[model samples]
Target: MSHFIKQNDPSDLFFPGGLFLNSDTFPTSFFSLFPSSSSSSKASTVSCFSWGPTSRTKVVSVFSVIGGGGGGDFLSLSLSFNSRSNEDHQKHGRESRENVEQHEKKKVCEEEEKENNNVGLVSHGSGAINMTKHLWAGAVAAMVSRTFVAPLERLKLEYIVRGEQRNLFELIQAIATSQGLKGFWKGNFVNILRTAPFKAINFYAYDTYRNKLTRMMGNEESTNFERFVAGAAAGITATLLCLPMDTIRTVMVAPGGEALGGIVGALRHVIKTEGFFSLYKGLVPSIISMAPSGAVFYGVYDILKTAYLHSPEGMKRIEHMKEEDQGLNALEQLELGPFRTLLYGAIAGCCSEAATYPFEVIRRQLQMQVSTTRMNAMATCVKIVEQGGVPALYAGLTPSLLQVLPSAAISYLVYEFMKIVLKVESS
Candidate 1:
């Protein structure tokens, strides 16, 4: 909220023969140099020195100068010290209390500064309030993006779970013919419930991990490798934490699993038939796929964003904004407009899905397995290969990309928009 403006002044002040002062010692009588303001027009000098050598403390000087006393213009100076005799121990307890209070106040001020240094994980310093904003932004982003891609998401899940038999057009025709337009989002409510927390955790975990890494490496800015590592760790943590919701969502959206009802009904069915642990059905494949999937997803976005920001095109955009006075600092210049943010995110999501589609298929298939038909990650991969050859491992990749591209784009767009709305700055 504060801005700088340079001022030009012709007034000046100077000292002749150099005014030298020593920290180790000071004369007790500063008033001897000049008479009182009422007696003469000569300026008076005041000096206040605080000494703390005995406690291994640094001496500090704090003073204020006020010219003009009554009618004449004069400089007033006062010098005083608080060195009490050791024998005067009566006020020792009060002094100790005052010292403690001063120390505590100073500490509080420092902590406040540290807390507000930046905005959440995007800032140089993060606090709980900032992190909460990140969580909220992430949740909103996930929900919005997933909702926009619900139809494609359902179609993609069907292709992954039911094996590759029909082409995209044929599948669309079948869904329309059998279930009508509404069928495209049959379990979208459940999807939202599952996705919101997953993304919230994903984004929060990424920020937390990246912040820690930044500090550990003592880097002024996060590198692409650090972003990848943080994204991967975030994926692992999020997938593991939200396994139950994820498992239920996978089943609820798959072909015959629609009969399982809503979230509560699905929960009871899975728990009763497959035991409680069934909730975490495909954790192994989830972690494996998600780790790299997340790495590419976040890393690509960050790398591309950095590249664009430094590119002539991006620099031009920033410069334009700066000339218009819309940009305030270097950090503000890093933020891309809505279209660019979406484009970068779309690219990142597409690359991530394309690179990790096989693992995703395996993970989803493993999630489809129940207690009676359990399969490990390797076995699931082998089965898919046997069923439809190597290509089968990438079944639904087209729809997956379709779903993820806009989904990721919107996620980032919404996230950045939320940051603006929340008054939190982007990194």
Candidate 2:
């Protein structure tokens, strides 16, 4: 059999071995990139391959003819093969790579989410621990400071209740002569028991209120008014909860008050003789005094502390103290300086005491009287005014100031110092 080669127009060409071809050589390049095995091609030489483009893909085709001829008679076979376009293959490869990349990104995001959850748990635990520490420090500081001034507190209570205006020296002499040194700390245990929980609640509640208000306002710093209101609210809450303990302490410490053994005895005696409500005898007056007193005290203290911390003189003093201590940081130096902190604390205490002094007198009278003899806060005020004039309301002012100034100073100093120490130790 002889084979004839032909050129089809100018665009088609002929090749050896009865193969007809075209000018477009892309199919040859595609075959070069993805060569089929000779064995596979021979085994499947049915010579018909069909393919088409899809919406997601594109197709390329190759065509050839094989023939044998004798004289004018001829036998011919045509073969066609389809392959994917390069652009379609590239597009599929890109999609596969993108899917893998997205999976890896999802894994990374899940890990980050787990880490954030752990951090949040840690932060919540740390905050709870800090609040507990703050409350403990405040309670301890109040107890220590109150104990330190227990004698002065007893003397002041006597002066107010007995309507005595004796000089401090005469008062001391009288107490010593009549009841000896033991008289100075007669009701100290009750005072401590009362003060510990009172101060704890006061400090913790104040902090809670301040934090909530700060978040509500979306501010890092609280205004003076906000501070005042928070302090008042804290005081009112504490007083209401601790009224029984306060009333018992007042009754036990008042001049010529009957001996009730101890805190338990005092409580029992009031309950048995006066009724349960009697334990809260002066609650109204106490709240009236304490709310404003707490507002003044905290407001003044915070304002002064902030002012001092930012002041040129205060900074110089802190720097000097830091230089002397050498081991202390700026914050430690500020907290450790007893004199300056005490001075501000005393000022705050004195201001608060002055504003609320008359209410103290009224509260004491109410606590001392029996239930039947008890008068309303307004009536008590009128009686005191009529009996001893307006000045009578300030009968114990001198000793009260003397007692509170140092008590407040020492309490604040101890609280701040303890807080710093606790923080450092915890860290």
Candidate 3:
């Protein structure tokens, strides 16, 4: 780090003019001729006359200066045609290269800043090292997010299963009336246990596939179409891996009084009661929903990051820095600017969630309905609509929207921070 301070001294002003000027062009006697307070106190003037052996043109120059008060001496710096030659051109090239190298070195100094500029698709393998680091970071973040929402997730399951509309307050009241205050979080422990690892697998697989597919298409940089495909792949992979867990959580969260002892118990109960395929009742809708939902979530984030980096203000900020000091590409810039990235991610997730809420409603109902019913996701959706109108398919939309905004934002923000931390620690 370099600290630069301004020096205040009259002599400092003379250093540049003396070093560059020729004695013939600006003689010592000229300084004496400069206007003092006694000569001129009102204004400054300049008159130029040239005369010498090379006097193709003779010019005489005169300048007036006002002393005291606020006015002070002014120094002029300019490069005339005579000053620039082949030698200067060569010098300029050397200086430019030095600046480039300096910029590269400075960027290396701030590894964290560099990390912030990185924008990785859920897909696209940067390299083995980054792949592992990103995967672990995403997995850990997913677990944290899921853990926090376990109780609400359980309540959502119950509400969906009962086919009822209940606001948060009423929902809490209902839970307390039937199962005590603890009932509000009836299956939360199991929900967390189920979703934490479940979400890890979900995000990991989604990103992995998304990256690979885009790479195959020669779009590892990932276009909008590519992002949609990548998000969809990741979502589907994750949804598949965790389908069984999804079923278990739904049942446990349902209004039923049966307290399945553990994950093993829950699985056993579902299989024994409703047959093996029952565990995947909502699989189709979930798979269908995951693709677009995931695509939109990540795609919107990328677009936001891209827009932020390209903005006028963003460009000015980068311009002020030494190119090497500002070690961020468009994507990397947003990572550095986490709040902007977060806003993008939040908006994207909310939009995705809202768009697919109908599918979500069907998936929830299929998973929670439990017995004597082999309802396909499509059939479930149709039934909900026919019975309770379109809004039935978006029963818990308020809560869903509420949960998504912050959860998605925090996940992305923390992910970016973690990347910075990892880069610093590793370096």
Candidate 4:
């Protein structure tokens, strides 16, 4: 076995200016402050220092500053250096660096959390403003479109109810002769009251359902099926909620009826004469007609829009328009530079209205008889078929299509344009 001798240097025990001459002369009272290990196999060194005994009060004050000022004890400090392998030293240094980095990361995360909280508040305020704008757009679109087609709508209602085959001019002259020029908009106020909120709810609900379903399916783009389903749900919900208003409007517009004073008077008369359920007399047929009609309309519209956007000419036109109108939204861009959007909207309206025309006749018949005969949807359909055969079920298809096509086209155009304008203004 080989023996190694340990050597200690005098300079290691002294301060820079020779404050301590040797290790033996250093204060021994504060030695207990330092931990001493007797295991010499592990090479280690301990250095202890304190203010002199003569300045014990000053030492206590210095200790207070260095030791968090908790006690009056004299100042004492110990520094220990342990000899270890290079790997151990490197490991310790890495751990110290990691701890510092973790602390800094925690501080940054706290700041980001605070900033996100503020952003959430701002987003909530903006969300409410956006919803209000959407409601306004929907209400305005419904009122304008309905107003434009009021005369045709009244004529169609008369044909469906009375089986009148008069031409447009004759129908107008008859209404003028009976109720004067104001008869052109016989039940327009009731229509507006019914349609405004109905359209607004439909629009808002469709967007809500579409967004939720898209997120659930993890899809950025919704398929035509999704759009159709969302539209059907929106239509059904709106129709069910607003069925009473629709029934009242139909009754007020039917030709050869005693004039109801106004919406309030019509509602009171219906409820007083024929119970509350009369207000929703044809709800089943109305839902049956509207659900599929809304589905077809929205599905066709979405399919047509997608097809147009995918066409080379449509893409080129959009790019050209983008250069001219940088503020256009995605929907507005689809409408740019062509009447294709109008044509597509008209086609969708025609298809949906044609498919559901028979149901419209059935619904109108049921509503018209609210004060007279209380017939279920099945009885009404059977009676109509017996009286005039299957063609009677489609009595007013021509005027219905004529009125609906332009109404749908104009409503969609105005709605999409308003959304873009509002978005741009807000931005």
| Best model per lDDT | 2
Mark the 10 consecutive residues where model 1 has the least summed lDDT: 1-10
Candidate 4 residues 1-427, lDDT tens each? 0121111454444334222223243454544454445332221234334443322221212111011121111222343333343345556668878989999999999999999989998888888888888877778878998999888887787788677878877887888999897787877878889998888777766776766777788897888778888878878988888899998887666653456776777788889989998898889998998899888877788788878778997788767776868765556564533276678878888888998889888888888884556778999899999999999998888888989999888777766666666662231
Candidate 1, residue 299: Cα displacement in angstroms equals 0.6
TM-score for all predictions? Answer: 0.69, 0.71, 0.61, 0.72
Q: How high is the CA lDDT of each candidate model? A: 0.76, 0.77, 0.65, 0.72
Residue pairs in clash, model 1: 45-77, 46-77, 46-78
Best by TM-score: 4
Model 1 bad stretches (over 4 Å): 1-126, 319-334, 425-427
Q: What would the TM-score be for candidate 3 when compared with the true structure? A: 0.61
lDDT of 3 at 264: 80
TM-score of 1: 0.69
Of candidate 4, the 10-residue stretch with the lowest lDDT total is 62-71
| lDDT for each residue of candidate 2 in 1-427, tens digit (9 for 90 to 100) | 2334335454444445443433242343543433334532311122334443432343333332222231111123554332445566667778878999999999999999999999999988888888788888889889999999999998887788777777889989998999899889878888999998898788778777876887788987878888899889988999999889988888776644566776787888889999999988889889999999989988899888878767887788767776778677534665437787888889989999999999999988898888778788899999999999999899888889999999999888877777776662221
**Stretches of model 4 off by over 4 angstroms after superposition:** 1-112, 255-259, 327-338, 371-373, 424-427
User: Candidate 2, which ten residues in sequence have the lowest lDDT sum?
Assistant: 66-75
Candidate 2 runs further than 4 Å off: 1-113, 165-167, 211-215, 218-221, 254-259, 273-275, 317-326, 329-332, 424-427
Ranking by TM-score: 4, 2, 1, 3
